[model samples]
Target: MSEVTDLVEMLEKTGIPMSNELIEALLRTEPSDFTDFPLESFWHDFPVPFLVTDSGVTKTISAPHMIVTMLHHLELDEGLHVLLMGSKGGYLATLIDIICGHGGKVTIIEPHDEIAEHTSNVLERRKQCGLIRVLGKEALEDPAWDRDVDRVLFTGSIREIPDFVELLIEEGGFILGPFGGRIQQRLMKKEWQGGAWLETDLGGVVFGPMDIRESERGFPDPLFIADEFEDALILISSVLGENSEEVYRLERLVESLRELPPGLPEITSSFTEEEIIEHPVIELLMTEAEWLNELWPTFVDILGFDLEGIVPDLEEPLFGKRHADFTP
Candidate 1:
């Protein structure tokens, strides 16, 4: 308690817009209650990764700063329903559940299987968060999210508003998340008004590259990018066996990526983002970026696209919503 209290004070001193109610509510539980991450991690103002692999850090509890920024912007209070995407290892959900209280509901949709399992274990172990429900992509068949909610938070980054907002939310309330490209983005708040959503850029933020696999750069390395280019084409060709100049052109792009030092002595060039489409599941992605919205739904299930890869550039999240089973 002392350590977390000190951490909150530090955040306040740094001008985090934490209200007395939130601070007091948060103190009732600890980050440890939700995650087995190191205790020292809970005392800092940095993201604490709970899920990691050779693919890189797939998920993390938002740093204290980001957490407070989101909480303040969310305008959370008792009895407001909140829909959250991604578990953040259950830490953020726990806080939201506390703030919303017994009368309120906090529904979390965690796309990753392991992450969702971890969060469910955490919630089950910590019985205090009685108002929260964590649902994985499979359980999503029940359409629980279709209900009205006061707010929606995408823990990972997104490029556009989720399509479901039209039917899931009335012409009122807010949707908050970081929106933009995989490399850069800003927190955006969309307020429903006059049967339309008015957008506001809250501030710049570095969000989850949300790619299932990544290197130092959230995007795959140059060589891997080439491999994926080849993979995407193959997947498309597998589905639509017809060949064309566009396929040939894309094949050449893949070859260019594969162009390494001709000899063991070796040479290579760094591929720019433009040359390398960033999302990890390129093979699963539509070969033609322009046709994604149209092709995504019919093809994604066959590709087995999952929640872990959220596919930042994907326009329609519905196609990207298949329950995830990752490569070992």
Candidate 2:
């Protein structure tokens, strides 16, 4: 088998599912194009988070799992305009260039000067300069930065969404990022709709914080809170008994939700109220409602939304309960 095929099979063996399309993308691209280290060392599925420097200061490249998961959330396509808030050695950005192919365009904003310069040099050498634009850190703070993108992905965590980001996305465009404080962080997806931003939780994620200076310029209220509800449920279920039928059911439900397509409406519309409350996952959460109630309010307060209104309550019997309670 080819090295790419071997890598794909190895990842699958480790329980990281890979769609054929994603496999093809990886197969066609070279890891050395992004990583400073030898690609042979990463021939198998492995956690490869590492530090690189542009001018003696250190910056991080995220782990492979996080990169793949974020890409899955982006649901990229040819010709789409994408904006990336952070460039970590330009590894993920290069992978995106491979997927977007010829027609797509990528605009990247990197805060560190040396890192951006290094990334630009690499892209130019790889003949990908035509596909991507690397901008200075101050560009994001500029009111005039392009905001017509179809998709946005943040490589780092942030306490609140940046105002410029909100203005940059075209209607129906979505942004994905690990959002929350150091103690709690979850990957959040937000889309612009009619004039408001609708948000959803894509489960938990751990990422480093955004540059402190940039984060200070973010909006007052984050659109969504970091969600750890499902994680809590899993822990609670395990303590209750790992082999129980209910625990198995909850595990399946969590997996299903994690693999669901991005966007709040797409996920919420897929299931009915009967399908939701009756699901083992929902039942498990309800059984531990008192515990969840204690945790839910803090998330609700951070998001500035009513948790009860968003989630389906046993008392409410709503249609989008699955999304309402857990995601947004």
Candidate 3:
């Protein structure tokens, strides 16, 4: 089989879906051209957000599932102008370059000087430097920056959509980013109308916080945490049979929140699993599950049993302290 077919098969076997167009785009681009590792060794069917800098900061090459989802939402067309806000690894930028071809222009803004230089050097070595621009500074600092872009994508998470982002968009353009703080986040889509921006929730995602100068502090907004908690509850309920009163209550709450508006109040930080468990709703559900003895595999699965230390710690609070004080 061809290498592209192998990649497609691998993604399918691992339950990571991608559109045929994206699969073909991946086939056309060479992963080795962008990364330090060999493509054959590094390409795998998993969400591998690897560290790209010595500072321990990482970038999501975005699993095939996320790439496909983001592309679908962006509605990208050939020759459209694109601006990428981060460039820790040039994997996603490289893919965008291929899809845009010779007609489209891609400008990358990387705040970290070392990573920006490294990415530019690699692309140059591969002879793919033309039709692309890499700036090693804050995105807004570049005087030559184009304000009218057809699409914008931020590879990191932000607490709120910045006002400047709208200024960067041409009328009717859109920006996609992971919105929220550490521990909890959601993929958000924002489109520019003539005078206002329209936003949509694109579901949950895990991402590192945006590399801004200001530090994010404190706990996430209660409403945001509640929304994410409800999503987890719904997922767990789906596997455990969704007919329980607890599930119904959680669903109703989620629905009510959805009716409020597109954006939730801005949150500064995120809740630990311990803090999440302390919520009255979560406590009530756990107690109910224990009463029926249905909290073993289901709860363990949602929290991730094989995730090493994370699951064990989560188990202690919900199942352990509440029951026999089991320690694993």
Candidate 4:
């Protein structure tokens, strides 16, 4: 969103920039199959909890909007090598697998053994295990490779962006994740510009801790989290442009929407006319920009689909192929 020199050049390497193809890819691979949670939980546009560690910390797959947003900016293309810090239920990995094709490679570092195993089983079941390698943090000790990976992604929150991440990427590569304090973070982007990395604030998100043990930091301070967005609340402000009266008005609406309980209620499963208009998230999106109104409904339809019998196009990766992928 900046006109600065480094950020400008970094944007040129971006691929897919929208969520439609990602949604369609998701339909081909059932999200329910990747999680132990019930189907009801898997179908909503919210962070669905699938694993709880012995530490009593719960892990969740990011909401659909957040997933699409992260992958959208990740700039997936065929033949890329991506290093993922979190497994993301193998859901995100699988999506990456879809986009990267046979020439691509993914190395997922999942610190939790249970999650790592679960992700491996699902990928093997889907026959995608061949394209990805699931390992623990120990793998970082020896990141031996001839060239740098094209991208690095983190699905959870980190207190701050780690310095060592830059070593794992090439000149044009980038790292995308939530970087900030517990319970709230700015989704920051760090792009390697050959000389140095340039950063961009992708907006706010409240992903789970990078380590379940991070709960020791104490509960979220409302003072800090008051500005955070949960589930699809991030979407309301994601594409809003430069600081202006319109942006402020939308921010006010986001404040109101944030007051609602996290995750969509069961009513969203079966949308009636009254329910669509009355839904706070939908209202916020439709009111933010007239064109964006279509996006929310489109997501509703995609999330409501039956994934049982659909088949995805494995020969060709769909991400970054859309017209929107052409520009920064």
Most accurate candidate by TM-score: 1
Q: For candidate 1, write residues 232-326 as lDDT tens digits.
A: 56555554554855457667656655663322211113544333343333432334444343344333433233323323343444233221221
TM-score computed on alpha carbons, candidate 3: 0.60
Q: Per-residue lDDT of 2-69 in model 4, one digit per residue for the tens?
A: 21222223333343255544544555566766777864443445677767878786777876667768
Model 2, 1-328: lDDT tens digits are 3765677677667666556656667777666666666555466444453345644545656655666778888988878888888777777777787788788888888877777887788777776623888998677777666667999898877777877778788989998998875446889999889988798999987776676354333211111121333444444454456785545654554565455333333114456767655554344445555434544454344333343432455563322222223445
Q: What TM-score would candidate 1 get against the native?
A: 0.63
Q: Which stretches of candidate 3 lie over 4 Å from their true place?
A: 1-3, 10-21, 38-42, 47-52, 56-60, 127-130, 143-146, 213-328
TM values, all candidates: 0.63, 0.60, 0.60, 0.58
Clashes (N, CA, C under 3 Å) per candidate: 1, 4, 1, 1
List the lowest-lDDT window of 10 residues for candidate 3. 319-328
Arranged by TM-score with the best first, the candidates are: 1, 2, 3, 4
Over 254-309, each residue of candidate 3 has an lDDT whose tens digit, in order, gives 56544544443232236466655554434444544443233334434443322223
| Model 3 accuracy (lDDT, Cα) | 0.62
The residue ranges of model 1 lying beyond 4 angstroms of the native Cα positions read: 53-58, 138-145, 210-328
Which model, 2 or 4, shows the larger lDDT? 2
> What is the C-alpha local distance difference test score of candidate 2?
0.64
Query: Which stretches of model 4 miss by more than 4 angstroms?
Result: 1-21, 212-328
Which has the greatest lDDT? Answer: 1
Worst 10 residues of 2 by lDDT: 218-227
